[model samples]
Target: MYCRNCGNEVSEKAIMCVACGTPPLAGNRYCPNCKAETSPDAGICIRCGVGLINTSNHSEFDWLTTLLLCLFLGTFGIHRFYTKSIGIGIVQLLTLGGCGLWTLIDFIMIVVGNFRDGNGKVVVNKQRA
Candidate 1:
């Protein structure tokens, strides 16, 4: 993978670019897959056609409902179910949310607005329609 901000080569599991101090996939200035320059508003890499996934994008799930479910029934993976993550929800249920560790991590992620839904879109705080 490459840093989208600086086009610098980075490890696949890298959290941020060592050279630019930016999250690997957090920028649209370059393609993380191909290291090619890209427009900020471009959806995909014109060269490699790789989709530039952005965390700022919204999901269909509502933030308030998801937070409420996780707070109330997180151990049961109710939040996962509400987010349409059926497979992980089952796993979470069977494992009691990884013996609570997974649930705790998920709670933190959700509270920080960093949790992604089943479709990979960030579950952001937004007003209901």
Candidate 2:
């Protein structure tokens, strides 16, 4: 493997690049698989055909806020609205949260930290992360 920042060869499991003093995959100047130079915003490494997604990062939505909203105003789909799930929020609002069954299920999902935002990102507490 190679450091994406400096193109310095690195152990596959290494955390940071010794040559550049940065996370091995944190930069976009080079490809980690083939050491080929890459455009900053390129999603794939051209030479190696490898994806460039940073696997170390997982962006999660707030769990507490979603949980509380679901507990208190789920019947009105307030939690859904807060998560930017506008279409589902409107449906829930019109249907009164599926006559409360949907609200109950959503509350349970939130309590179990299994809820997702409109963007499909998982909702989890920062401490848990």
| TM-score on alpha carbons, each prediction | 0.56, 0.57
lDDT of 1 by residue, 3-98 (tens): 888889999999988999987877668888888899976888899999885643556788998888888888899999999999999999999989
How big is the positional error of residue 75 in model 2, measured in Å on the Cα after superposition? 0.5
Write model 2 residue lDDT over 1-129, tens digit each, in one string: 999889999999889899999989877788898899998768898888999865223224578888888888999999999998889999999999999999999888877767778877567666764
Clash pairs, model 2 backbone? none
Lowest-lDDT window of 10 residues in candidate 2?
53-62
lDDT of 1 at 121: 73
Model 2 misplacement above 4 A: 1-60
How much lDDT does each candidate structure score?
0.85, 0.82
